[model samples]
Target: MSQEFESIWDAIEPTVGDALVMKVRFKIMSAIIRECRLWKVSRNIASKRLNIGVLRYDQLLACDIASFNIDELVVLSLKAGLDVRLEVQGA
Candidate 1:
């Protein structure tokens, strides 16, 4: 199994694969963000595609270094890593 799968499974349930989990999380996050009325952004297919892990990390990193999918896996992994910068400062 890929390292991505290791992190992704740990972030979410093993039963729900990374791709599906990413999609579901995106939908939920999108709805929450929409109702917040804070950002004027809408969920795009490209963002979802990025979360799909269609391309290897090396390939993705080579071209667009800013294209990391900050979805559930990344959030959980960062939290696990004790990366306080990723934490909400005040709230």
Candidate 2:
């Protein structure tokens, strides 16, 4: 039951060459997950938390990597109860 991005990351990791860079890519992916949660919740509840124009919000969350920023990603993972870690590829 893995996600599309998770499967994509599994295949992409080995080709990244550098473990550090690969970890960064994972971090970005984690952020994308968070953004998805925010988008979903807002949509479901019709949240007033979002003040931006609908078009802008739509454009922002529409990207595949919408939540690729570290700060937002950390928040998303925390909210989702995901214990994120920085690990070496082979470790």
lDDT per residue, candidate 1, 45-77, as tens digits? 323433434343233324332343545434433
The estimated TM-scores of all candidates read: 0.26, 0.35
In candidate 1 the C-alpha lDDT for residue 52 amounts to 37
Over 1-91, each residue of candidate 2 has an lDDT whose tens digit, in order, gives 7555445545656664444454564665546445556555664232234333445445435643443455654544555556667655673
lDDT of each: 0.39, 0.50
The local lDDT score (0 to 100) that residue 23 gets in candidate 2 is 57
The C-alpha stretches of model 1 lying farther than 4 A from their native spots are 1-16, 38-91
Off by over 4 Å in 2: 1-42, 45-63, 88-91
| lDDT, residue 33, model 2 | 47
